[model samples]
Target: MPQSSPRLIGVGGGKGGVGKSIVALTIARVLSDRGDEVVLADLDLGAANLHTYLGIHGRVPTLSDFIAGGMADLSPLLVDTPMPRVHLIAGGVGSLKTANPTFQSKMKLLRHISRLSADWVVLDLGAGVHYNTLDFFNAAHYRVVVTQPEAGAVLNAYGFIKSALLRRISRVFSKDKNLTKALEERVSTTRSRGLLTFCLTDRLSMSPILRGLMMNTGRD
Candidate 1:
Protein backbone atom coordinates (compact mmCIF):
# COMPACT_ATOMS: atom_id res chain seq x y z
CA MET A 1 0.00 0.00 0.00
CA PRO A 2 1.17 3.48 -0.70
CA GLN A 3 2.06 5.61 2.29
CA SER A 4 -0.17 8.57 3.04
CA SER A 5 1.29 12.02 3.45
CA PRO A 6 0.95 13.87 6.75
CA ARG A 7 -1.82 16.45 7.01
CA LEU A 8 -0.85 20.10 7.47
CA ILE A 9 -3.45 22.38 9.06
CA GLY A 10 -2.70 26.04 9.63
CA VAL A 11 -4.82 28.13 12.00
CA GLY A 12 -4.58 31.91 11.86
CA GLY A 13 -6.43 35.17 12.52
CA GLY A 14 -6.19 38.90 11.81
CA LYS A 15 -5.47 39.82 15.41
CA GLY A 16 -4.96 38.49 18.90
CA GLY A 17 -7.78 37.40 21.24
CA VAL A 18 -9.56 35.58 18.44
CA GLY A 19 -9.05 32.10 19.86
CA LYS A 20 -6.56 31.05 17.18
CA SER A 21 -4.43 29.01 19.55
CA ILE A 22 -7.50 27.61 21.24
CA VAL A 23 -8.78 26.33 17.93
CA ALA A 24 -5.41 24.88 16.98
CA LEU A 25 -5.14 23.11 20.31
CA THR A 26 -8.67 21.78 20.08
CA ILE A 27 -8.01 20.36 16.64
CA ALA A 28 -4.75 18.79 17.80
CA ARG A 29 -6.44 17.18 20.77
CA VAL A 30 -9.23 15.78 18.61
CA LEU A 31 -6.75 14.33 16.14
CA SER A 32 -4.58 12.85 18.87
CA ASP A 33 -7.58 11.34 20.58
CA ARG A 34 -8.34 9.53 17.35
CA GLY A 35 -5.00 7.70 17.65
CA ASP A 36 -3.11 9.97 15.28
CA GLU A 37 0.25 11.28 16.33
CA VAL A 38 -0.07 15.06 16.23
CA VAL A 39 2.46 17.88 16.38
CA LEU A 40 1.07 21.25 17.42
CA ALA A 41 3.53 23.94 16.41
CA ASP A 42 3.33 27.46 17.74
CA LEU A 43 4.48 29.54 14.77
CA ASP A 44 3.55 32.94 16.23
CA LEU A 45 7.22 34.04 16.41
CA GLY A 46 7.02 37.44 18.13
CA ALA A 47 4.48 36.90 20.92
CA ALA A 48 4.01 33.20 21.48
CA ASN A 49 1.78 32.17 24.35
CA LEU A 50 0.43 28.80 23.28
CA HIS A 51 2.36 27.20 26.09
CA THR A 52 0.44 29.32 28.56
CA TYR A 53 -2.82 28.07 27.11
CA LEU A 54 -1.57 24.50 27.47
CA GLY A 55 -0.55 25.31 31.06
CA ILE A 56 3.14 24.78 30.23
CA HIS A 57 5.38 26.84 32.48
CA GLY A 58 9.08 27.64 32.43
CA ARG A 59 11.25 27.64 29.34
CA VAL A 60 11.32 24.96 26.69
CA PRO A 61 13.36 24.54 23.55
CA THR A 62 11.51 26.46 20.86
CA LEU A 63 11.70 27.15 17.16
CA SER A 64 14.33 29.72 18.04
CA ASP A 65 16.73 26.93 18.98
CA PHE A 66 16.27 25.29 15.63
CA ILE A 67 16.59 28.58 13.81
CA ALA A 68 19.72 29.46 15.75
CA GLY A 69 21.37 26.12 14.84
CA GLY A 70 21.19 24.92 18.41
CA MET A 71 19.54 21.69 17.21
CA ALA A 72 20.09 19.65 14.10
CA ASP A 73 16.70 18.00 14.13
CA LEU A 74 13.39 19.52 15.23
CA SER A 75 12.38 16.31 16.99
CA PRO A 76 14.59 17.12 19.98
CA LEU A 77 12.68 20.36 20.49
CA LEU A 78 9.36 18.59 20.49
CA VAL A 79 8.34 18.78 24.14
CA ASP A 80 5.90 16.08 25.08
CA THR A 81 2.62 17.60 26.16
CA PRO A 82 0.38 16.17 28.86
CA MET A 83 -2.05 14.98 26.23
CA PRO A 84 -1.38 11.57 24.78
CA ARG A 85 -0.10 11.38 21.21
CA VAL A 86 0.23 15.17 21.13
CA HIS A 87 3.60 16.91 21.09
CA LEU A 88 4.44 20.59 20.85
CA ILE A 89 7.22 22.77 19.48
CA ALA A 90 6.72 25.96 21.42
CA GLY A 91 7.11 29.32 19.73
CA GLY A 92 9.83 31.74 20.74
CA VAL A 93 8.70 34.41 23.17
CA GLY A 94 9.77 37.95 22.27
CA SER A 95 11.84 36.63 19.38
CA LEU A 96 11.27 39.59 17.12
CA LYS A 97 13.85 38.31 14.64
CA THR A 98 11.86 35.16 14.20
CA ALA A 99 8.93 37.32 13.12
CA ASN A 100 10.75 37.81 9.83
CA PRO A 101 12.86 34.74 9.24
CA THR A 102 14.90 34.56 6.08
CA PHE A 103 13.48 32.70 3.11
CA GLN A 104 16.05 29.94 3.50
CA SER A 105 15.15 29.45 7.15
CA LYS A 106 11.46 29.36 6.34
CA MET A 107 12.09 26.80 3.65
CA LYS A 108 14.19 24.69 5.99
CA LEU A 109 11.52 24.71 8.69
CA LEU A 110 8.76 23.93 6.22
CA ARG A 111 10.75 21.02 4.83
CA HIS A 112 11.37 19.59 8.27
CA ILE A 113 7.73 20.05 9.17
CA SER A 114 6.58 18.24 6.07
CA ARG A 115 8.85 15.32 6.91
CA LEU A 116 7.77 15.12 10.56
CA SER A 117 6.66 11.66 11.61
CA ALA A 118 3.09 12.43 12.47
CA ASP A 119 -0.41 11.97 11.17
CA TRP A 120 -1.23 15.65 11.52
CA VAL A 121 0.79 18.87 11.88
CA VAL A 122 -1.11 21.88 13.13
CA LEU A 123 0.63 25.25 12.76
CA ASP A 124 -0.74 28.02 14.99
CA LEU A 125 0.24 31.19 13.19
CA GLY A 126 0.44 34.66 14.72
CA ALA A 127 -2.15 37.36 14.23
CA GLY A 128 -1.87 39.86 11.37
CA VAL A 129 -1.33 39.63 7.61
CA HIS A 130 2.44 39.79 7.58
CA TYR A 131 4.08 38.10 4.63
CA ASN A 132 5.70 35.51 6.86
CA THR A 133 2.38 34.64 8.45
CA LEU A 134 0.62 34.43 5.10
CA ASP A 135 3.39 32.29 3.63
CA PHE A 136 3.09 29.76 6.42
CA PHE A 137 -0.70 29.82 6.16
CA ASN A 138 -0.48 29.11 2.45
CA ALA A 139 1.92 26.23 2.98
CA ALA A 140 -0.70 24.25 4.80
CA HIS A 141 -2.89 21.69 3.05
CA TYR A 142 -5.80 23.29 4.92
CA ARG A 143 -6.06 26.85 6.25
CA VAL A 144 -8.51 28.15 8.86
CA VAL A 145 -9.25 31.78 9.56
CA VAL A 146 -10.62 32.55 13.01
CA THR A 147 -12.72 35.60 13.79
CA GLN A 148 -15.09 37.00 16.37
CA PRO A 149 -18.55 38.64 16.33
CA GLU A 150 -17.28 42.19 16.80
CA ALA A 151 -17.25 44.58 13.86
CA GLY A 152 -13.56 45.27 14.31
CA ALA A 153 -12.77 41.60 14.32
CA VAL A 154 -14.86 41.09 11.21
CA LEU A 155 -13.08 43.92 9.40
CA ASN A 156 -9.69 42.68 10.40
CA ALA A 157 -10.61 39.22 9.29
CA TYR A 158 -11.63 40.58 5.92
CA GLY A 159 -8.34 42.42 5.63
CA PHE A 160 -6.45 39.27 6.48
CA ILE A 161 -8.26 37.27 3.79
CA LYS A 162 -7.70 39.98 1.20
CA SER A 163 -4.04 40.20 2.10
CA ALA A 164 -3.59 36.46 1.79
CA LEU A 165 -5.31 36.44 -1.59
CA LEU A 166 -3.18 39.28 -2.88
CA ARG A 167 0.01 37.63 -1.64
CA ARG A 168 -0.94 34.38 -3.31
CA ILE A 169 -1.64 36.18 -6.54
CA SER A 170 1.67 38.01 -6.38
CA ARG A 171 3.57 34.77 -5.78
CA VAL A 172 1.80 32.91 -8.58
CA PHE A 173 2.68 35.59 -11.13
CA SER A 174 5.99 36.69 -9.68
CA LYS A 175 7.94 35.63 -12.75
CA ASP A 176 5.72 37.80 -14.94
CA LYS A 177 6.45 41.23 -13.58
CA ASN A 178 3.97 43.08 -15.82
CA LEU A 179 1.20 40.63 -15.06
CA THR A 180 1.89 40.83 -11.36
CA LYS A 181 1.85 44.60 -11.49
CA ALA A 182 -1.50 44.59 -13.20
CA LEU A 183 -2.90 42.18 -10.63
CA GLU A 184 -1.71 44.37 -7.80
CA GLU A 185 -3.35 47.41 -9.31
CA ARG A 186 -6.60 45.56 -9.65
CA VAL A 187 -6.41 44.31 -6.09
CA SER A 188 -5.73 47.81 -4.81
CA THR A 189 -8.61 49.32 -6.74
CA THR A 190 -10.93 46.61 -5.51
CA ARG A 191 -9.87 47.01 -1.90
CA SER A 192 -10.47 50.77 -2.09
CA ARG A 193 -14.04 50.05 -3.09
CA GLY A 194 -14.70 47.22 -0.58
CA LEU A 195 -13.59 43.81 0.52
CA LEU A 196 -13.87 41.29 -2.36
CA THR A 197 -14.98 44.06 -4.72
CA PHE A 198 -13.13 42.39 -7.59
CA CYS A 199 -14.73 39.83 -9.83
CA LEU A 200 -14.39 36.25 -8.66
CA THR A 201 -14.65 35.03 -12.24
CA ASP A 202 -11.54 36.96 -13.23
CA ARG A 203 -9.52 35.60 -10.34
CA LEU A 204 -10.74 32.07 -11.01
CA SER A 205 -9.77 32.39 -14.67
CA MET A 206 -6.24 33.45 -13.77
CA SER A 207 -4.97 30.05 -12.66
CA PRO A 208 -6.27 26.79 -11.29
CA ILE A 209 -3.76 27.06 -8.46
CA LEU A 210 -5.17 30.43 -7.40
CA ARG A 211 -8.72 29.22 -7.66
CA GLY A 212 -7.77 26.36 -5.39
CA LEU A 213 -6.36 28.82 -2.87
CA MET A 214 -9.63 30.71 -2.71
CA MET A 215 -11.87 27.69 -2.43
CA ASN A 216 -9.78 25.51 -0.13
CA THR A 217 -10.37 27.58 3.02
CA GLY A 218 -11.05 25.12 5.85
CA ARG A 219 -13.13 25.68 8.96
CA ASP A 220 -11.46 26.04 12.34
Candidate 2:
Protein backbone atom coordinates (compact mmCIF):
# COMPACT_ATOMS: atom_id res chain seq x y z
CA MET A 1 0.00 0.00 0.00
CA PRO A 2 1.08 3.59 -0.66
CA GLN A 3 1.83 6.06 2.09
CA SER A 4 -0.93 8.43 3.13
CA SER A 5 -0.67 12.24 3.11
CA PRO A 6 2.23 13.81 4.96
CA ARG A 7 1.71 15.35 8.38
CA LEU A 8 1.99 19.16 8.16
CA ILE A 9 3.60 21.10 11.01
CA GLY A 10 3.08 24.88 10.95
CA VAL A 11 5.31 27.35 12.82
CA GLY A 12 3.95 30.84 13.27
CA GLY A 13 3.74 33.84 15.60
CA GLY A 14 2.17 37.30 15.50
CA LYS A 15 5.41 39.25 15.79
CA GLY A 16 8.37 39.21 13.47
CA GLY A 17 11.96 38.33 14.53
CA VAL A 18 10.66 35.53 16.71
CA GLY A 19 12.68 32.81 14.94
CA LYS A 20 9.70 31.01 13.41
CA SER A 21 11.74 29.97 10.39
CA ILE A 22 14.59 28.65 12.52
CA VAL A 23 12.16 26.70 14.64
CA ALA A 24 10.54 25.25 11.55
CA LEU A 25 13.88 24.27 10.07
CA THR A 26 14.93 22.64 13.32
CA ILE A 27 11.74 20.59 13.41
CA ALA A 28 12.37 19.34 9.89
CA ARG A 29 15.94 18.43 10.70
CA VAL A 30 14.96 16.51 13.82
CA LEU A 31 12.27 14.58 11.99
CA SER A 32 14.56 13.80 9.04
CA ASP A 33 17.21 12.55 11.44
CA ARG A 34 14.68 10.01 12.65
CA GLY A 35 14.60 8.44 9.16
CA ASP A 36 11.56 10.35 7.92
CA GLU A 37 11.46 12.31 4.67
CA VAL A 38 10.59 15.91 5.43
CA VAL A 39 9.71 18.86 3.24
CA LEU A 40 10.50 22.30 4.63
CA ALA A 41 8.25 24.86 2.94
CA ASP A 42 8.90 28.55 3.19
CA LEU A 43 5.31 29.76 3.52
CA ASP A 44 6.45 33.17 4.76
CA LEU A 45 5.28 34.51 1.37
CA GLY A 46 6.92 37.80 0.30
CA ALA A 47 9.50 37.76 3.10
CA ALA A 48 10.78 34.23 2.54
CA ASN A 49 14.34 33.61 3.68
CA LEU A 50 14.37 29.94 4.62
CA HIS A 51 16.58 29.28 1.62
CA THR A 52 19.28 31.55 3.00
CA TYR A 53 19.35 29.66 6.28
CA LEU A 54 19.91 26.44 4.36
CA GLY A 55 22.72 28.14 2.39
CA ILE A 56 20.73 27.80 -0.84
CA HIS A 57 21.40 30.72 -3.15
CA GLY A 58 20.60 31.82 -6.68
CA ARG A 59 17.23 31.82 -8.40
CA VAL A 60 15.09 28.72 -8.01
CA PRO A 61 11.53 27.63 -8.65
CA THR A 62 9.47 28.45 -5.56
CA LEU A 63 5.93 28.49 -4.21
CA SER A 64 5.56 31.80 -6.07
CA ASP A 65 5.61 29.95 -9.37
CA PHE A 66 2.67 27.79 -8.36
CA ILE A 67 0.77 30.75 -6.89
CA ALA A 68 1.44 32.75 -10.06
CA GLY A 69 0.06 29.98 -12.27
CA GLY A 70 3.47 29.17 -13.68
CA MET A 71 3.42 25.69 -12.16
CA ALA A 72 0.69 23.12 -11.65
CA ASP A 73 1.99 21.00 -8.79
CA LEU A 74 3.99 21.77 -5.64
CA SER A 75 6.05 18.61 -6.04
CA PRO A 76 7.87 20.11 -9.02
CA LEU A 77 9.18 22.94 -6.86
CA LEU A 78 10.88 20.69 -4.33
CA VAL A 79 14.59 21.52 -4.04
CA ASP A 80 17.20 19.50 -2.20
CA THR A 81 18.59 20.96 0.99
CA PRO A 82 21.97 20.26 2.61
CA MET A 83 20.23 18.13 5.24
CA PRO A 84 19.71 14.53 4.27
CA ARG A 85 16.09 13.43 3.82
CA VAL A 86 14.96 17.03 3.93
CA HIS A 87 13.62 18.81 0.83
CA LEU A 88 12.65 22.44 0.49
CA ILE A 89 9.88 24.37 -1.23
CA ALA A 90 11.22 27.91 -1.24
CA GLY A 91 9.08 30.99 -0.68
CA GLY A 92 10.52 32.86 -3.67
CA VAL A 93 11.46 36.50 -4.01
CA GLY A 94 8.13 37.57 -5.42
CA SER A 95 6.43 40.92 -5.16
CA LEU A 96 4.18 41.87 -2.25
CA LYS A 97 1.13 40.88 -4.28
CA THR A 98 2.19 37.26 -4.14
CA ALA A 99 1.99 37.37 -0.36
CA ASN A 100 -1.74 37.93 -0.46
CA PRO A 101 -2.96 35.26 -2.85
CA THR A 102 -6.60 34.93 -3.90
CA PHE A 103 -8.82 32.56 -1.93
CA GLN A 104 -9.00 30.18 -4.85
CA SER A 105 -5.25 30.27 -5.24
CA LYS A 106 -4.72 29.65 -1.54
CA MET A 107 -7.03 26.62 -1.61
CA LYS A 108 -5.28 25.24 -4.65
CA LEU A 109 -1.87 25.65 -3.05
CA LEU A 110 -3.05 23.95 0.11
CA ARG A 111 -4.56 21.09 -1.87
CA HIS A 112 -1.28 20.55 -3.66
CA ILE A 113 0.59 20.69 -0.37
CA SER A 114 -1.50 17.82 1.03
CA ARG A 115 -0.40 15.64 -1.87
CA LEU A 116 3.34 16.18 -1.38
CA SER A 117 5.25 12.89 -1.15
CA ALA A 118 6.92 13.16 2.18
CA ASP A 119 6.45 11.81 5.68
CA TRP A 120 6.34 15.34 7.10
CA VAL A 121 5.94 18.93 5.88
CA VAL A 122 7.22 21.84 7.95
CA LEU A 123 5.68 25.22 7.14
CA ASP A 124 7.39 28.48 8.13
CA LEU A 125 4.58 31.00 8.35
CA GLY A 126 4.95 34.77 8.24
CA ALA A 127 4.15 37.06 11.11
CA GLY A 128 0.76 38.66 11.73
CA VAL A 129 -2.77 37.20 11.73
CA HIS A 130 -3.60 37.50 8.03
CA TYR A 131 -6.38 35.22 6.91
CA ASN A 132 -3.97 33.27 4.72
CA THR A 133 -1.54 32.82 7.61
CA LEU A 134 -4.26 31.68 10.01
CA ASP A 135 -5.77 29.29 7.48
CA PHE A 136 -2.40 27.75 6.69
CA PHE A 137 -1.58 27.45 10.39
CA ASN A 138 -4.93 25.83 11.05
CA ALA A 139 -4.47 23.45 8.14
CA ALA A 140 -1.47 21.86 9.79
CA HIS A 141 -1.76 18.70 11.91
CA TYR A 142 0.50 20.38 14.50
CA ARG A 143 0.71 24.11 15.18
CA VAL A 144 3.59 25.85 16.99
CA VAL A 145 3.81 29.43 18.15
CA VAL A 146 7.37 30.77 18.46
CA THR A 147 8.20 33.66 20.69
CA GLN A 148 11.08 35.29 22.54
CA PRO A 149 11.31 35.80 26.30
CA GLU A 150 9.94 39.32 26.27
CA ALA A 151 6.69 41.00 27.18
CA GLY A 152 5.93 42.19 23.65
CA ALA A 153 6.72 38.85 22.08
CA VAL A 154 4.53 36.98 24.56
CA LEU A 155 1.65 39.43 24.02
CA ASN A 156 1.86 39.11 20.25
CA ALA A 157 2.05 35.35 20.49
CA TYR A 158 -1.06 35.36 22.63
CA GLY A 159 -2.84 37.55 20.09
CA PHE A 160 -1.90 35.19 17.26
CA ILE A 161 -3.21 32.19 19.17
CA LYS A 162 -6.45 34.00 19.90
CA SER A 163 -6.96 34.95 16.27
CA ALA A 164 -6.20 31.45 15.02
CA LEU A 165 -8.59 29.88 17.54
CA LEU A 166 -11.35 32.36 16.71
CA ARG A 167 -10.91 31.66 13.03
CA ARG A 168 -11.16 27.94 13.69
CA ILE A 169 -14.32 28.45 15.69
CA SER A 170 -15.83 30.59 12.96
CA ARG A 171 -15.11 27.92 10.36
CA VAL A 172 -16.54 25.13 12.51
CA PHE A 173 -19.74 26.99 13.23
CA SER A 174 -20.19 28.90 10.02
CA LYS A 175 -23.72 27.61 9.50
CA ASP A 176 -24.96 28.20 13.05
CA LYS A 177 -25.57 31.93 13.37
CA ASN A 178 -26.83 31.79 16.95
CA LEU A 179 -23.97 29.76 18.27
CA THR A 180 -21.45 31.85 16.41
CA LYS A 181 -22.91 35.04 17.80
CA ALA A 182 -22.92 33.69 21.27
CA LEU A 183 -19.31 32.59 21.03
CA GLU A 184 -18.28 35.94 19.61
CA GLU A 185 -20.03 37.73 22.43
CA ARG A 186 -18.44 35.47 24.95
CA VAL A 187 -14.99 36.08 23.55
CA SER A 188 -15.45 39.85 23.40
CA THR A 189 -16.67 40.08 26.97
CA THR A 190 -13.91 37.90 28.43
CA ARG A 191 -11.00 40.22 29.23
CA SER A 192 -8.73 37.50 30.57
CA ARG A 193 -5.76 36.43 28.49
CA GLY A 194 -6.70 32.82 29.16
CA LEU A 195 -10.09 33.24 27.53
CA LEU A 196 -9.52 30.60 24.85
CA THR A 197 -8.58 27.91 27.38
CA PHE A 198 -11.49 28.88 29.57
CA CYS A 199 -13.99 28.68 26.72
CA LEU A 200 -12.66 25.36 25.43
CA THR A 201 -12.62 23.66 28.84
CA ASP A 202 -15.19 25.48 30.94
CA ARG A 203 -18.36 27.18 29.72
CA LEU A 204 -18.26 25.97 26.08
CA SER A 205 -18.01 22.37 27.31
CA MET A 206 -21.58 22.74 28.54
CA SER A 207 -22.79 22.43 24.93
CA PRO A 208 -22.57 18.99 23.39
CA ILE A 209 -22.27 20.45 19.92
CA LEU A 210 -19.31 22.56 20.93
CA ARG A 211 -17.68 19.63 22.70
CA GLY A 212 -18.02 17.56 19.58
CA LEU A 213 -16.64 20.33 17.40
CA MET A 214 -13.64 20.79 19.68
CA MET A 215 -12.92 17.09 19.58
CA ASN A 216 -13.15 17.04 15.80
CA THR A 217 -10.91 20.07 15.56
CA GLY A 218 -8.25 18.31 17.63
CA ARG A 219 -8.39 15.24 15.41
CA ASP A 220 -8.14 17.36 12.30
Query: Which predicted model would earn the best lDDT?
Result: 2
lDDT of 2 at 220: 14
Candidate 2 Cα errors over 4 Å, as ranges: 191-220
lDDT of 1 by residue, 80-136 (tens): 888999989898887766767888898899888888888888999989988889988
Q: What lDDT tens digits, residue by residue, belong to model 2 across residues 1-220? A: 1198998888888999888887888778777887889999898989899999999999888877888796768878999999999999999675766788998998898999999989888899999999999999989877677788789998898788878878888889999989988887776576765655743454342335323332432211
Report the Cα RMSD per candidate.
5.7, 7.3
Clashing pairs in 1: none
Model 1 CA deviation exceeding 4 Å by range? 1-4, 189-220
How does each model score on lDDT?
0.79, 0.81
Enumerate clash totals for all models, in the order shown.
Answer: 0, 0
lDDT of 2: 0.81
Error of 2 at 116 (Å): 0.5
